[model samples]
Target: MRRSRLTVVGNAVALPLLLAVLWWVASADSESIYFPSLQKILGAFPETWLDDGWGSSIIVDGVPSVARLAIGFASAALIAVALGTAIGLHPRLRAFVEPILELVRAIPGPVLVPVVSLFAGIGDGMKVAVITLGALWPILLNTIDGVRGVDPVMTETARSYHLSRPRRLIALVLPAASPQIFAGMRQGLSVGIILMVISEMFAATNGLGFSVVQFQRNFALPEMWTGIIVLGTLGLLASLVLQFAETRVLRWYTGLRAADHES
Candidate 1:
């Protein structure tokens, strides 16, 4: 534990130092290049915030992005888990659907951006659909892996005990499958964040992505840098939160391993 903590602290220290060096290198030649310095970007943040009406209209800008992400990711999760579970639990269903899944997963998410934009016309719905489509593959694929990987012993035990279908799923399968489910969720989340920004950048009038494009087009280099930094920070923060949640929720499985190691 102490070693792990030290390793974490080391990485935390190292990352900032590396970033600072990169920032300095970029700043020195910033006049010739499109890159802005860390300091300049930091300085621009408040002004950008103010100009965007962060006090009153932050919601107008931010809410749309957040709401779209939430809706799209939730929809993706529901459909992916449902369909993946069905496929995983039944060999026949897998045989029927795997080909279709393979084809859909083969297509890049951004390729659909034009199609979505054409039909939906830069609306929130289009953005949400893009996010959902982009995120669905990872979740669905991971879920299929998880469900199929559930312990056969547990399944047999449930059957021997005459467990009902719902009971078997809830008691015997879900707990066993939770780790994989969480893994899928993590993949989905990362992909969803990417698609969210992409959709906004290409299609929406208001979002962090839009903010980046707006600043870049206006040649506000510092503000553009600030937006990019914020987007990266948001993605990092969100991933971190999900990781923490996963740790908390899967304490039992993790703790069991820890206990075994101690023994």
Candidate 2:
């Protein structure tokens, strides 16, 4: 297991290093203002990101962007799981409300940015609301499916044991449904990131998205690229954190799958 993990880490580091080397070679001595050399981008990274002793862009822009993503995604996941659990537990309720859900999910999240801004007024509330709205559907739908698809035998067993509703939810339902829930959360995380940027694109100042756009408008290609790099790094870190949490939360599921594979 340790060897396998080491190999994974090695591959992750090696691929990016190889790509950076290739890009450095390819763009060396290039004079294109639009696509600056990777070297120039790297050179600008510290100054742009850490402007004025690290309180300029990264601290101001990047932090809020990530905070919005975390809040929105976490809220979406929590609300979806709760609603999904309740709806999945009742067949009639699921059937009745599903169409409305499908209808709402059909509309793209970006389309609602203007609408949301009207009510929320172009503040952090607007951005967070947009992110949450955009991130909500996938997890909500997946959680519903996960809960509904929990093992029937396990459900019956819990019933026979006369477990309380909360007890069953904690001991059986959630565990069984976790794989699907994680899948949804993974999908939702990406949506949340996209929305974070798009939400900041309009009527917002002091966010990573705003900074990136400002850089581009002024032809600060290196700084724009740096902002993108920072955003990408944020996404990577968030994904790693989520994966770590998933590994801990679903350790039993992982072992079961491994055993099945071996068998």
Candidate 3:
């Protein structure tokens, strides 16, 4: 436990130190790459983010982008989990759908942006559709894997208890499958965030991506850098929160793993 905790702390320290060194190195050649100094970039963040009422713009753009992502992701989750559970329980359905799913997943998400835009017209609908397309497959595939991976003994025990179909699924399958579902969700979230930004960059009038593009085109390098940094920070925070939640929710699974190691 102590070693694991130290490892986490070490990584936390090392990553920032590495980033600092990289920032310094990159900025040293500022004359060539036109890179901003670390301090200058940090200093400009507040003005770019808050001054000129970019705060309002960010809120307007960011809120809509996030709302689209959330709506799309939630819809995808429900559909994926339901379809995945059905496919998992039925071998024929799994075989029938797996290839189609694989094909969809294989297609690059960015490629669909144009098609979605064409159909949906650079609107929130298009953005949500693309985000859903990008996020759904991982969750569906993971759900199938998780449900199928549940121990036979557990299923047998549930059946022996005369559990109803809904009760069995709710009490047994879901709990057994949660870890993999969460894993899928993590993957979906990563893809979803990327898609959200890409969709915004391609068409939106306001958003982090739009702001970055606006700054770049206007030669506001400091602001562009600030936008990039803020986006990175947002991704980092989202991933950390998800990971922490996953750990808390799967404590029993983690404890079981630890016990097995001890034995």
lDDT of 3 at 167: 96
Q: Judge candidate 2 against the unseen true structure and give its global Cα lDDT, from 0 to 1.
A: 0.87
- Predicted candidate 2 versus true structure: per-residue lDDT over 1-263, tens digit per residue: 67855675576568667888999999998899988999999999888887643234677887888899989998999998899889988999999999999899999888978999999999999999988888888998999999999989988999999999999999999889899999999999999999999999898778888888888888888888988888888887787788778877988998999999999
User: What RMSD does each model have against the real structure?
Assistant: 3.1, 1.8, 2.8
Q: Model-by-model lDDT, in order?
A: 0.79, 0.87, 0.81
TM-score of 1: 0.87
User: Against the true structure, what is each candidate's TM-score?
Assistant: 0.87, 0.94, 0.88
Higher-ranked by TM-score: 1 or 2? 2
lDDT tens string, model 1, 141-194? 988888899988889988999999999887767677778888888888888888
Superposition error at 217 for model 1 (Å)? 1.1
- In angstroms, the error of model 3 at 37 is 1.9
TM-score (C-alpha, index-matched) for candidate 2: 0.94
* Candidate number with the higher TM-score (1 or 3): 3
User: How many pairs of residues collide in each model?
Assistant: 0, 0, 0
